[model samples]
Target: MTEETRRKAALVGAFERGAATYEQLGVDFFGPPGVELVHRAGVRSGQRVLDVGCGRGAVLVPAARAVGATGRVVGIDLAPTMVELTRAEVRAAGLSQVQVELGDAESPALPPGEFDVVLGGFVVFLLSDPAAALRGYRRLLCPDGRIGMTTFASQDPRFTEAMQMLVGYLPADRRRSPTSEHDALFATAESTAVLLRETGYRDVHVTDAAFESRFRDVEHWSAWIWSHGARSLLEQIPARRLPEALAEVTPVVERARAVAGDLVFTTTVRFAVAVSPG
Candidate 1:
């Protein structure tokens, strides 16, 4: 496999192992924002929708509900475990309009010109070939179909502070080559817009929103890290250095809580919506 493919495999495997905790954590981190974004997209009854990287069906379920009984929602993800979790949720929720499948966003296993709306949350940055993925999504849409995507606007200051401390404690090489840093992909809005334009999407709109979350204590931050795949960055480090890294991050977390007051951490998220011209 190519290096990019291998990295994606590792990333998907890590998320699969963390799926249960991810679902639990996602209820707070991703659920509400996803709903709000879809609502903003103004889905109507009988509009066909596709949810790319529909992890645990957070976005898909709501889209299905919005579309009513006449419409359909198809969710695609790279991880089999994610697909299973999404399917189980759909069954339990009794949402017949929603279905889940295992597939890559770069080359979704979907027929062209099928969907009226295509949406996903926090998935754009995760794609290895985001431009190619967007081009593929464009093909899957009907004439004048719209796409909505959500991603981090900038690293949350609190999260970045904690990460900086942890990296400081790691060996120099590991710190410099950290897996969690995707410097090339999500660094700026201009770059993201350029990518979307290059992929053939037009009338792109981007907006930023902030949310505040509270972690009871440092342990909560630690748990969040493990549950959100940040722990994978520590996997290659020597076991002896793990404690030191965690220790370094603890003070940063504590400082953030103090600055936040009531232990609330703030994150800034950006959403982009674009339409494919007929």
Candidate 2:
């Protein structure tokens, strides 16, 4: 398989493993940029919308609501589990206009010109061929339609430290943190804007927002880590050294919660939006 395809597959695997815990800890608990991104993309009533890398309807569900009964909202994700989870949520919420399909966010092959707003949540950087995918999204938008997506500007400081601590303990070959792979994607809003413009988007704009993710204490913090995709780090721990690793990581957690009675993990998120020249 091609290297880019393999990277996409690994990303799908990571999300599949974390699908069940994603909404609560990863989206709501950690603050997914769905609602914010939807608004930025101008998802108005009666509009047809597509959410790339929908991830349990973080953006899809809200966009469905924004579009109301007259509009349609479709979501695509690489993981079957995420697709099924989003479908279930849509059913439970009685949102008949919302549909979730299993597809590669990197190259969603959905029909073109059907959507007025194409939104993505935490999708751009993870894409195997982001520029190609942006062009694909451009083709999917109706004339005058716009596209928007969120990428991480930075992760919480404590979370980064605890993550580094875990990676620091692992063998050299296994020392990479999951998020380290996409650090350059949203490093600067100007860079993100340049990408949109280069991909044939006009009136491109980038905005930033800070979101706080909180944990009651270390117990809650550890649970959140293990329950999410970050558990990949925990899984890498040598079975023999697991206990030692946990013990060593405790101080890092303790220091993180030192000042705040509740540990607040704050991250800066960047949203890039632009219009299809049509």
Candidate 3:
């Protein structure tokens, strides 16, 4: 298989395995950003919306509410487990306007110009070809339809150090963090805005929001890591090395502990929005 195909397969497997705990951890990491993404996307009542990589319905749930009963919200994910669980959650929440499907966020299989808004909450950077995905999103939107997404401007320094420290425990051939591979496209607000504009989007706007998430302790912090895309990295280390890996990462993480003892990390997120020039 091609490199991109292999990368996508691995990502799907990681997310499928992490479906249960993804964002279900006690930390408030995804929710705040999800809500902020929807609000910034300007989802209007009665509009048709498409939420790409709608893991656990973080963006889906709020967009559904924002669009009201008259609107339609279709969420797509590559992992069947995420799609299945999110479907159940939508039903349980009685969001009749939302539909969850097992599909690819990179290039959803739908007709062109069918949606009024398209949202990618902390998921665009994970795509195998983010620029191509942006182009596809433009095709999926109605005239002047908007697209809004969030990408990390910077991770907490301690979190970065801890992750870097974990890299030492991985086998020699598999010592790279998956996130590091795609950091350039999302390296800065101007860079992302330039990407959108180059891909035919207009009126690009980029803003930053800093979110602070606190974990009860070291174990809580470790579980939080395993609960999301970060698990991809942790899972690569040999099972036998996990304890030693944790032992090494602990002190680095502890340095971020608050006075009350909760581990705190502030992530700077960049929110970018633009209009399709139909």
Candidate 4:
């Protein structure tokens, strides 16, 4: 398989393995950012929305609500489990206007110019070819349609240190985490905005916001990490070294403990919105 295909497959498999617990953990990690993405995209009633990498309906549900009954929302993800679970949630919520499907976020096989807005929440940097994906998303939009994506502007220092600490337990060949691998693409607001402009989008706007996620303690933090993409790194650490890894990461995270005893991390998320050229 081609390298990009291999990367996509690996991402699907990793997320499939964690789908059962993905975003199910009691943390406000994805929700706040997801909602903010929809709002920033200026989604409105009767508009069509496509949520790429719509994990657990985080962005899907809110976009659905924003569009209301007259509008339609389609959510696509590479992981079948993510699609299946998100569909179940959509059904449970009676969001008939929303549909979740198993499809690629990088290049969805849908007709061009069929959507009013496309939102990628914390999923752009994970793509094998983010620029290509952005260009494809622009093709999926109608003239003047907007696309909004969220990427990490900055992660908490404690969270960064703890992740690095965990990497020490990984085999030498696997020591680098995925976060480090994709950091450059969305490293700065200007860089990300330039990417959008280069990808044939116009009126690009990039903004940053801080969201606070809390964990009861180190154990809670562990569960939270395992439920999302961060699990990729944790999965690489040999099973025998899991305890050693966690033991070392705990103190680094504890350094962020709030006065009330909950471990708090303030993640700075960059939201970029741009309009499709006619």
Lowest-sum lDDT 10-residue window in model 2: 23-32
The runs of at least 3 residues in candidate 2 whose Cα sits more than 4 Å from the true structure, single-residue gaps closed, are 25-32, 177-182, 258-260
Ordered list by TM-score, greatest first: 3, 4, 2, 1
Candidate 4 per-residue lDDT, tens place, 1-278, comes to: 98557656766788888898887888898899999999999999999999999989888999999999999999999889999999998999999999999988879999999999999998989987788999888889999999999998889999989888887877897766554556676889988988999999999999999999998999989988888887778887889989888988888889989887789999999999999995
lDDT of 2 at 244: 78
Please report how far candidate 2 places residue 261 from its true position, in Å: 2.6
Clashes of each: 0, 0, 0, 0
Worst 10 residues of 4 by lDDT: 174-183
Q: Please, what are the lDDT tens digits per residue for candidate 1 over residues 1-278?
A: 88776777767777777676774752267777688778877778999999998887768888998999999999988878888988997989899988898888878888899999999888867777677788888889999898888888766676887777666665676565424455565566776676677788888887788876667777776777766556556555578987877887777677766654545677777777888873
TM-scores, all candidates, are 0.90, 0.91, 0.98, 0.96
Query: Of the pair 1 and 2, which is ahead by lDDT?
Result: 2
What local distance difference test score does each model get?
A: 0.77, 0.79, 0.90, 0.89
Q: After superposition, how far is residue 174 of candidate 2 from its true place, in Å?
A: 3.5
Off by over 4 Å in 3: none
Best by lDDT: 3
- Cα miss at 98, model 2 (Å)? 0.3
Per-residue lDDT, model 2, residue 118, is 88
Is 3 or 4 the stronger prediction by TM-score? 3
Clashing pairs in 4: none
Worst 10 residues of 3 by lDDT: 176-185
**Over the full model, what C-alpha lDDT does candidate 3 score relative to the true structure?**
0.90
Tens digit per residue, CA lDDT, model 3, 1-278: 98768777887889999999998987889889999999998889999999999999889999999999999999999999999999999999999999999988878999999999999988989987889999999999999999999898889999999988888887888786665677787888888998999889999999999999999888999998988888888888889999998988899999888887788999998899899986
